[model samples]
Target: MTVHLFLGPTLAAAEAAAVLDAVILPPAAHGDVYRAAQRGATVIGIVDGYFEVMPAVWHKEILWAMREGVHVLGSASMGALRAVELAPFGMEGVGAVFEAYQRAELADDDEVAVAHAPAAYGYRPLSVAMVNIRATLAAAEERGVIRPATRVAMLRIAKQLFYPDRSYPRLLSEASATGLDAGELSALKDFLPEGQIDQKRADALAMLRVIEARLSAGLAPKQVRYHFEATIFWDSLRQDAAPLAEPGEGSWMQSALLDEARLHPVAYPLARKGALTRLLSRALSDEHTPRPLDDETDAAILSFRRARGLLHAEAMEGWLRANGLGAEEFARLMESEAQVAAVQRWAAPHISSHVVDQLRLDDLYVRLWARAREKQRLLEEAGLADPDLAAAPLSREELLAWYAERRGEGAAPRDLSEAALQAGFRDEPMFVRALLREYHYVRLCEPRER
Candidate 1:
C-alpha cells in the first residue's frame, strides 16, 4: 500500500522519510486529504496541518476519503484533533497527544499549536507548544526540580501566553513576575537544559513509526463502521478536483468558475446565479429529466458508435480511451444523453421564444426578484403584529382560492399545474405545501397593502 504522510514542524521531511519511505507532503490544508484520496493513496498519515493561516482541513473531506476505502491515521498536531473527532468512524489516533485528546486531557487547540519556520527551513519550531511545556513541567515535578504548585503556576503562565510568544525563557520570566517563588524559578531554569521535553516531536515520531509498522505488516484497509454521506460539501470537493478542460485554460472547476465570476463580475455573475439555481433544483430532485429504458440507452450508444466509426468493440475502446472515459462511464454518458433528450422533449413546448426575448429586453429576472422580495418584506412586517396569524397553516382550499384570486398576476400562476412546474416542485404534495405558505403571505399582505 502506498502511504502518503503530511508532516511539518513536528517532524522534518527527511527525518520522516527515514522512518517511512512514503510520499511526504507539507502540513495539510483544506482539501489536501480529498486530493490524496483522489490520487489513489491507500494509506494517509497526517501529523501536522495549518489552522490559523487559512481554513483547516474539513472533517467531511476526511470522512469522504474513509468512505472511499482509504485508511487514514492521525497524531501529533492538527492530526490529533481530527483523529479524536473522527475516531468513531475508524480513523486511527497514535501517540500521547492523540491519547490526551481522546481522553479529554487536552481541550484547547492552542495546546498543540506553535509557530514554525518556512518550508525552506524544514519547518523548524520557532515557538513552544503548550503540550510540550506541560510535558517538560511534569518531568520537572517528577525530578523535584520544581514543586507541584510551582509547576502548576508555570504551566498556567505558559498556557496563558499566545502560541506565537510561547518559549521557555518567556515562560520562566513570566513565572517570576507573577508570584512564583524565585528559588523554584531558578531550579526550573537549571533543570531546563536537560529536562525540556519535545513532546510534539515525540508524538509526531510515534505516528510515523505507527505508519511504518502498518506498512511493514501489509495491513488491509480498515473498514469504517458508519456509512459516509455524500453531502453538498463533499460533492463540491469532488467537482472541484476534476481535471482541467485543456492545458492552459486553468482547471475546469467550480472554484475556478467562482474566481472567474469575481474577476469579471459583469460577465459571469448572472450566469453563475443561473447555474446555482439549476444545481439547487437538481439537488431537491425537482428537475430530474426522464431516464430512458436500458434498451433505449443501448440503441443510442450503438447509433453513436456507428456514426463515429466505432462499430467494433476495439474501435469503441479506442474512442473511450481518447475521451478519457472508462467503459462504465461511457455507458453512463449514453444514459445521461437519453435523459437530456427526454428533458428537451418535455420542455420544448413550454419554452416560448417570444416570452424569453421580452423578458431579456425588460431585464425581467432582476426586477421580478426584487419586487418579490419587497412584497415578502411588506407581508412579514404586517404579520409581525399578530405572530399567531403568521404561524397559522393555510388549508389546500384556501391555497386554490388564493391562486384563483391572483390568477395571471406576477406572483401567482395562470394555471395551477404550470405554477407548480415553474416553481420546480416535482410532486403535488410539495406544490400544495409551498402554495399554503404563499397563501398566508398573500392573505396577510392584502389587508395592509390594499
Candidate 2:
C-alpha cells in the first residue's frame, strides 16, 4: 500500500503533490537508492530525460525498485527509454506531457484530458496529453482493464517516439490524438529495430541466459537462480511481493544454500554427495536448538529441574531420557548450553551451596566419562582388559560420603574434601596422585578394638 515517488531535479510542485505518499525523492549527496527501498516504500517515479542521459543514478534506482517489487514510472525525459527497457518487468513510460495535452484539444473534452493529466501540468493541454497515453496504459495495466496486446501497442508507440531527437510539441499532439507518435521524425536511425528479435524479448532472453550460466556455475539453485529470476520479475514491475520481518526470516533456506555451497565441492559426485549429506543431516537434526532461557525462562527451567529431583548428574541423565531427549535433541540443547548457563547465573544470583554442589558433580561426571573413554582406549592398545578398570566406578554420592566421613574424624585436611579433590583432579590429578602415592605407599591403618 506504500507508494514511493522518485522526484527528479526538475520536478514541479504540482507533480510532487500528486504522488506525495507514493514518491521517493532522489538521494541526497551521500544517499543511496537501494537504502531507500529498504525502508518499505513501494513505487518510484523518475522524469523521462533524467533516466536516459544520466543513467547511472536513474538505472540503479530503477533496477532496485524493479528487484524489490516497487513500481517505477517515467515521463518527459527518461520515461521513453524506461518504458521500452522496463516494459518486460511492467514499468510504464509516457512519451511527453504535451502529447496528452494535444489529445485534450482534438477531443475538445478538457475534462477527459484534465482527468487524464499526470497531476503535474494544469491547463497545459499539450504536456498533459503527452504523458496521458502512457499514464492511461499504466493505469489500465495496473487495473487489468485493458487487454495485454492493447497495452503492448500503446507502449510500443511511446517507446519509438518519446526520445531525445523528437519535437516535444508535435509528438505530444500526435500522441494525444492518435495515441501514436508516428510523424515527429528526427533521426529515424535511433528508433530503428536493434536486431531481428524484438529488443525487449531479446533482453528478457539475455537475462534468462545469465541466470542459466549462474546455475551451471554451481551457484545455489535457490539464491543465484530462482530468487534472482523472481527478483527480476518483481523488480520489473516495482511491487513488494512480501515483507521480510527480520534479517533471516524469509531467507533462512536461501541463506542455508550458502552453507551447502561452502561444504560441497563444485565438481561432480563429491558435490552431489556432500549436498545430500548436508540435507539429510539437517533433516535428522532437532527442530529448535535449546537456548539458555533468559533470566525468567532459566529460572523456570531450573526450578522445574529442581522440583523433579533432576539437579544432580544421575538424576539429570534419567530426566533427559524420560523426557525423550535423544541424540538429536541433546545436540540442540548442547549447542545452547553456554547461553543457558549465562541465563541461569544471571537469574539465580543467590543459589544455595547444594545447587552449586550438584552442578559441580554434573560437570565432574562428564569429565569422568571422557577420561574413562580415553583411558579405556589406552588400555585396549596396551592389551589390557579395560572393562576391569571401568568396573566399580566411583559414584558422586560415594565420593562425597567418603570425604565427609574423613573430614568428620579430622583424618583429612579441609582441602581434601570432595569438591577440592574434583577440582584438583581437573587441574592436575596425575601430579596429585603421584605425590600421594610417594608419601603413603604401603601405609596401613590399624583396626581399633571394639
Worst 10 residues of 2 by lDDT: 110-119
| Tens digit of per-residue lDDT, candidate 1, span 1-450 | 888889877988888888887899878877889889888899899988877535677888888888878989899899999999999888889989999989999999889987654444455666788999989999999998889888887888887886766889989888887888898889889999988999888988888888778778888776777877777876787776565463233356557766877799486877775556444434433355645776455545644653465533334444656666655567666666545444544654665665567677878967876766875686567653223323555545555666756665333332344345555555566677556556656666677877
Cα error, candidate 1, residue 304 (Å): 62
Model 1 CA deviation exceeding 4 Å by range: 241-450
How does residue 435 of candidate 1 score in lDDT? 62
Tens digit per residue, CA lDDT, model 2, 115-185: 11111221111222223444545554555444556556545555555221122343444445664333322
Clashes counted in candidate 2 amount to 38
lDDT of 2 at 411: 29
lDDT of each: 0.73, 0.39
Each prediction's number of clashing residue pairs: 0, 38
